[model samples]
Target chain A: MSGNSEMSPRRPRLAVWKLASCDGCQLTLLDCEDELLAVAGAVDIAYFREATSAAVDGPYDLSLVEGSITTAADARRIREVRAATTTLVTIGACATAGGVQALRNLGDIDDFKKAVYARPEFISTLATSTPIRDHVPVDFELRGCPISKRQLLETLSAFLARRTPNVPTESVCLECKRRGNVCVLVAHGTPCLGPVTQAGCGAICPAFHRGCYGCFGPQDTVNAPPLLTELQQLGLSPPQLERLLRTFNAEAPAFRAAAESLGAGGEK
Target chain B: MTERTIAVDYLARVEGEGALRARLDGDRVEEVELRIFEPPRFFEALLRGRSFEEAPDLTARICGICPVAYQMSASHAMESALGMHVTGTLRELRRLLYCGEWIESHSLHIYLLHAPDFLGFPDAVRMAKEFPEVVARGLSLKRAGNHLMEVLGGREIHPVNVRVGGFYRAPEREELEALRPELEKALGLAAETVRFASGLEFPDVEEDYEFVSLVHPDEYPMNEGLIRSSRGLEIPAARYEEEFEELQVPHSNALHSVRRGGGSYLVGPMARYALNRTRLLPKTRALANDVGLEPVVTNPARSIIVRSLEVHYACEEALRILSTYRRPEAAFVPPPATFEGGSGAAATEAPRGLLYHRYELSRERLIERARIVAPTSQNQKRIEDDLRHLLERQIRADDATLTDACERAIRHHDPCISCATHFLTLEVDRR
Candidate 1:
């Protein structure tokens, strides 16, 4: 908890890992232009493949893991991450839920890959992209396509403090209502996932007068079925309801279950 | 003779995952492979069955730094698919947004990533220790660009405010005015950046390049322009596929692109500068000349100067857009779509290079086929060609020197391989 870089010599070594998602999440650390140098003061930066060539041996104090476990290699790699770090924080939707790419978990991944590649045999992957928690324990999970910058800063701050980061587990409605933004769904009759989706992103979509598409995944407790019923009453067909749930955080358990049940034949 | 490899296990000072492998046969320069091993996301595959509306969000995942490029290009292509023509204020806003991307992306590369190689620093953070003012200017310039993106697109990366037809929300007049002070300051920094880069000690490396870019009339190309190059090649954006082709290289998952019958070509800052130097506003063009960068020049090593000049141009253009800002009533106009009968292809000048996207949407509006040609891919063979010749010159230099030379050569273009398997691996071999 002390801010002494020299006196408290064990400057907790940090390592960043990536799996089946964009490198944006880890780049958030590098993109910390204002605090990058000071950040290096707090950590040995033992291994961050995205940033530097200087890497040290790690039974790291902190490991910031990005991306989801999509391939079998990633599934195996998460174990190595958990083994290497005392505190493992998974950042972004890919690491927490299966990410937007996890939409394949709803269908056949092999078929998906084959449809894209000329030689699908060359590709190696698992049929599903699952969250980091599915394979190994994650000390914390930061949610977003690339994770929020403030959240990342807080998470790093917490690790340095040896306390849980102050990430709210509430719904997007709270952030939206706090921002005093008009409800896109309530006022404009837009079918939004804000009611079921988690906070963070400052309820960004709704603040801009657009309904939430839930880039931040589900809240700690979401009644997705009830939300689906609301969407249905607002004139969503069964497939329309399914498509709504099966986006961004499609592999998150509640949304995943909601997608399957809603996508079924004419679920009127 | 013993074989020595100057290997950078993970490529730094570049965008995305890549490695370089240089084979040395007693300094004869056997082969140099810029291996791009970044995992593929199958964006083109995921795009299928997706509404043309989803293209921006889906394809934006291809690269983080150049997400705006992906979004703009995808939006333009899909808009074309719908037989929509956007112009006036809406079109100007798109160009202004692109100017922001160019300034941010170019300054980041020219200062933080590419400049260090020339300045003999490991990275910009280290370079700041010696040249704090320069690095500060660079960050400020980059911040100005991010501010523009935030004001317009919402977030700097994979901005959510963008939709197929237009923005989910349009910036108000005050939002555009808020950017003016920062932009005016950015203009000064951009000029200083050119002076800094143009004065950098460049290792002598130049090659014959088929320079490619989007050329426009009365404006430096950004969002809307015809694809053209210094080699007298001209094609409408719609003919990008017919003019250029992509082929899978053995060492990469991303395909290399070239002129249909030609060997290799250059894109990105250097190429854009050489091809469209005249189109730049008076001040930026003057900066190019004052910095000893004449369009007729053939020095690839001096590409840094070109990128810096672009930083100047982008800053100036952004300020112009801001000063003349009138908040449009609508962010986008819904254009009509006539499917099957019409095929649309368009290329935009992404910060990296000319990003081309073409689609054959069937009558049912399902994507029948998709073609994407990233700037990194277009520059691949040209990079290898540069490596072969540049390393040959440094054949007598020590392994470290020669290897660094090769890395510098590849980084000169600021390649982003994520768009290709996606961008750089640094390997140096000497005998």
Candidate 2:
């Protein structure tokens, strides 16, 4: 299990980097309260700014990057981060897709700036929020608005053990059935993305009697056109369906295409 | 005259990114700037023209550490705008949900983020090596809180169940009952935490600062209250804009919140403790007494103690509510007919402090205007002010020592900068 890390006398150096998004995905590591100390014991947290003040000079063994490349400064900073790591893993929807803030990807950045700030001239932002892969190569991508804690642990464990992580690429419907949850879509006529959405969140929305909001982005083999047609039947207007697809994982290609096909721009 | 520069290019151990710079001539501190470089996501701008129903989930994305605060504040504001009120057991359930967030967020700040600074550790991971049991206790307590959130709201981060009127579906009686044993265990752990925190060596520093928070008449404030401050200022949540103003500075994307008549004031656990000590539940009050925490805590670093006490209160309150929880006949109240073309404002006690959300709804139930003032943004000026005070006192110290002290000082507010540049940089120049 300790194959790769054991090659060196020192522990594998791990660094976590942030770009522009909610700190949720990075927080998932901290939320590993039970396993955090153990994870630390297993590796060196060389540069995790949000969790520690101590930073070790990097040519890091593994890097976990969060957030998306939103600002020009971040665009350069991510390149620097890429140069310093052996293996890079993008965590959360923001890193994997463009995240919710990427809602800007489909609309006017200038108008967005003016709406949010009094002096839009002071703000410097990219026209669109883009994922890490758009700018740099990523060895792996862990998905979710905030990636599921169990999946996060598995990813970390696989890295520490020097093995490829066994992550499911199946749809959320499989998870819903596994959990014995009644399908909210079938029973209540609620529009749900569960059929095409990824499974990492364990069908949580259906358990709560709410339709899946697709926080995990899209399933690998998604045929979202059918899901959109079903949602239309279940009373989701084209605009409403578009808004649903463009939430946390807003700029993910599959979801983005689905929403675009519906004639709705990403902006609210 | 001599000049030297002490710079921390990146401020660490806080949520999000920010920078701090201070300039001094000899030992006289000249300028202090808490620069927030966390990229602005433009949440307030994005909320414009969206359905009011989207507010809870969309705003919850603002800060992952305190999603409940955003959700509760958004829900309450929308509910008020619709002229629909959730009361009785449903109201209690919402408070219970908030209590869960309080326990989770406070435990995280106190143990994982803030405590390592108090001790001589760079992070909690290092701290755990020396005091594994204490760290484990904190983690378990935090997990218990997350468990409650998972059961009620569907997931800890950006819970899916919370809607404007109420939850999408209320938890079954057994679902709540299942949390009892864990809460009981957490109660004991929280008690131990309060005692453990009380014994920690606190830095002997106090600043004369104004403390502000929401104060409920009958209960410790959570979802509802009147905005009050230690400086004899009291106003309804609707009057927040009337009392305070947001100033735009070139260095920060967040607007610095300053009172109309006064300057910067504190809003967080310290503020809540100072303003609502009399309103604390009985068990929490006794623990505060045992811990020797004064009603007015002036030391920012010692705010960890206040956070622990709040955790105790949250655990106790959650238990108190769960025991009598009866799954409501209907999960939520349907919105009233008066839901069109109205304005609503609400002040809820975020774990950090008072979070205010104001929304103007169009007749179509679309959000025409939205303004959200996160607690961290409100406390930015106060944080900078505290840094200046600390810098003046320790102006003669060496660069490394002084920079470390200043970083610890910023951590005192448990500043969620992600909530504020949308907020740290630490740099010191001495002459």
Candidate 1 per-residue lDDT over residues A120-175, each given as its tens digit: 77766677778889898778889987688889999898877777899998999999
Q: Local distance difference test, per candidate?
A: 0.76, 0.88
State in Å the error of residue B197, model 1. Answer: 1.0
Scored on chain A only, each candidate's TM-score is 0.92, 0.96
Residues A34-117 of candidate 2 have per-residue lDDT tens digits of: 788888888899999988888998798899999998999999999998999988999998899988888886668898888777
Query: Candidate 1 has what TM-score?
Result: 0.94
lDDT by residue for model 2 (B386-408), tens: 98888889888888898888888
Summing lDDT over every window of 10 consecutive residues in candidate 1 chain B, give the lowest-scoring window: B335-344
iRMSD, per candidate, in listed order: 3.0, 1.1
